[model samples]
Target: MSDSLCESVDSTNETPSKKTQLEDGSDSLSVIKKAVVVLTRLPEYKISALRPPTPQQFYSEDESHSSSDSDMEWEPEGDSGDSDFSVPDNKQKTGKPTQNDTTKTLPPQTSTNNDSVSEPAPIIISSAFAYCANEITKVRPNLPEEEVKVDMMVLARKRHMRWQRGKIVEIITREDGRLKYKVNFVEKGKSLVSGHHIAFDTTPKLEQLYVGARVVVNCQDETFRPAILAELPSRKNRLRFLVFLDDHIPVYVGLPFLHLVCRPLENVLDDVPDSPHKSFMSRYLRDWPNPHLTQYKAGYILNAELNGVQQRCEVQEVDSSLIHVVFKDNQHKEWIHRGSIRLEHMARFWELRRVQDVSD
Candidate 1:
């Protein structure tokens, strides 16, 4: 019994010591965890304190400098309370500009005036009649009557049994409800004519005034004289033409002063009746073939068919299979098959013109 009591006491003492040691170890581990947390937090605090300034802060500094350096002594144009800060009047007396002042005083922003900038002029296309396999229909003499208005220029059949240029001066309604126009022929006097005797004045195509064609030219003396077109107008010659008058007098006339009389199919040289003027004109009449016949190249103008209708097109690019072209009439771009292009031929051109003249 004595031995059992001694052993029990010793066990109780040892258990208390072990409990104390475990409690101390737990406290030391908690302290070490707290120290680790503090060490990590210290670096974050230092980094935040050393951070660079924000953009707003830099802008505020620039604003302060601008306020001090501006020469104008006026306050900002707004409610004083709305502004974050105000410039003192004393700062304005410096009369010196800061670096920011140069930027502020820079020339006012300029905008392009689209109206003042002129648009590029449209491409002026020379007109031509395309050769058609089908026959051209004639302009019917007894066609449907058209409505006429005052001050409209028209073709009126007057004294000479030929169509003459006239202007519609007045309108007359007959008892039968038929309308007659008081046509004022510039050369002839005014007379009343029915709608059947009047037609709209149409401008002839430039192709009809080709070189070697017959036309009546208004001479310098303002007299309309018979002449043969010696040379077509070109950019080099200021768009004027060289013509031989009936008396074999050569003259340069503007396009507006010439009227097409006829386009003969035969060579112009054949009709010249062997004279010095005829020999002089032969130099201009040497049948020049279409330039593109040798090779298709960029910027060359040629007759091309688009959607089965012939139109003048400027060549943009040429390849083995397709040719890129832009239509002169509407500026429409298209890729045309090589076969669709009709290169102009001198003999064929005159033949087509003859057919058109007969149809008209």
Candidate 2:
């Protein structure tokens, strides 16, 4: 028995192993230890030795507890079993847990918070451009609406192309995309022609190809045969046009529709007098010049007949794409490279009313 537990009631202080004693239970010290344990005070939690007193029992023991009602922490005097800090408030008592942890359990997609939304729903891709077998039937215009396309090329913008056979016309496309088309003009072969460009690879619409914007799209309507550019990543073969080739002149040939800008070189032949072309021009085509080279009906050269007779008359200019030369009597006037002729030629003939001018 421990001397410290001589007056205490707890049994743990006095229980000693039997081995600690000599084999006999007759030791006087062992008897004294048991007596000391029984006399000492026991812990209050030991159910066999003691039990907790009720609040009323405690108050009965001490009158000071009943007088101070505010001394109670969780429960006040008047409000029995009521607590101010307890959970489940009126606003949060609904089926759903309104705590921050519960709100976080909902998926972000279904969140009602507008600020959490990042992007609008994606748009579904529906209609698109499609490649079709070329039709050879020539679609003639009512022939009443004949207009010229100067600044822009309608065929290049729509990614459509046109070709002609003996008596049939063909239309082709380079890519599959949405389109709105109608027959615009018809030639001898009678191909269904529209003022649309042959769309190259997947590209934006004509509305997106704004002015001053660079674009590359394949040529689908240029010919009936399979185009080589259709196999490349960008179907458009590169065509470079400068609004200003040098210090002057605005050009427009680099687009999908490549038209050779042309003007008549007919004049009084001030430089070359008594030239064959200047003397007899009517006998040749006997027609006015075509402003654009591709639209020209025929080609001619000034040649002298055997007896002082001439096939051309004294004219200003003739339509030769590589060289806009005029042989008034018999003299070379002017010429340009096929690459740089669009705006240069257009500025001189159509706009300025001057062709074969060595002065400027």
Candidate 3:
């Protein structure tokens, strides 16, 4: 009985010791797990505390700097409070830099002076479809009816009839809901002051008029004034007029020159003389042709259209209305009517006059 009792006591003591050791081991394991978790979190906490917010974090700054102008000062005009400053959730996951993100810090901005402050809506200018294509009736003084109906058909049939290109200088709206425009015709050398409707033959592209474009200023006289397109000015109409090539001349730019500004001048010849017509003809013409062909020499140069192609030709033989000539390019002699051969001086005069008119 004594031996049995001693064994039972020893077993119970040993069991308690085993239980205490197990409990201690579990506590140590739990402590180690906690230490490992803390170590993982320490780097992230330190990095977040030390690093500054990236440019992508600020949506407003990113949007305003999209134009690459770091110094551009912009702010939400309204009082939206903290909403504008919030970073998007998707941006947090991606962490990629956007096109708008810039390194430069944005200055603190206040609200605009007025709540009404906002970007100006683009002005959509009307196209050629807006103008009236039909013929307009004009009143004549000292006439039987005091009114003349200029037929549109007759005007269309006439070759080289004046269809003056003009800009709407002023717009006036009538009580009848009809809009009238005051147009300044560059070719006509006059401004149509009253109820005249103007049309754009070719609409000017505002993007093309940006800096460093070669251009010409359309004038009423028989001279082409060349200029260079410069920085586009801030205008409500969005038309670029300010240029600095020759003397600062206000004139129309573009085909059928209308409006006041730089028009693109392509393929302008070098050393355009004081007299473009005289110089142009002097190069090809061995002898200038008189208006009446009855008084011209054999080797006269004539500007003629052969097979609908305008060319310089040398007169080989003159036979009344039929004159034999050879084209500068081709040696094959051909006969043309006297009317087909444009007189040298007359052709030059008209050519220079047209150049001044179109400013091309």
Question: Which candidate should be chosen as best, given lDDT against the real structure?
Answer: 1
Compared with the true structure, all predictions reach lDDT values of 0.45, 0.24, 0.33
What TM-score would every model get versus the actual structure? Answer: 0.25, 0.14, 0.17
How far residue 251's Cα lies from its native spot in candidate 1, in Å, is 2.3
Off by over 4 Å in 2: 1-252, 256-324, 330-360
Clashes of 3: 1
Tens-place lDDT per residue, model 3, 219-317, is: 456343444333233211123243332332223233333222221123222312344322432331212111111122255454555555666666665
Clashing pairs in 3: 253-263
What's the C-alpha lDDT at position 113 in model 3?
Answer: 27
Stretches of candidate 1 off by over 4 Å are 1-203, 263-265, 269-273, 287-360
TM value for model 1 = 0.25
Tell me which residue pairs clash in candidate 1: none
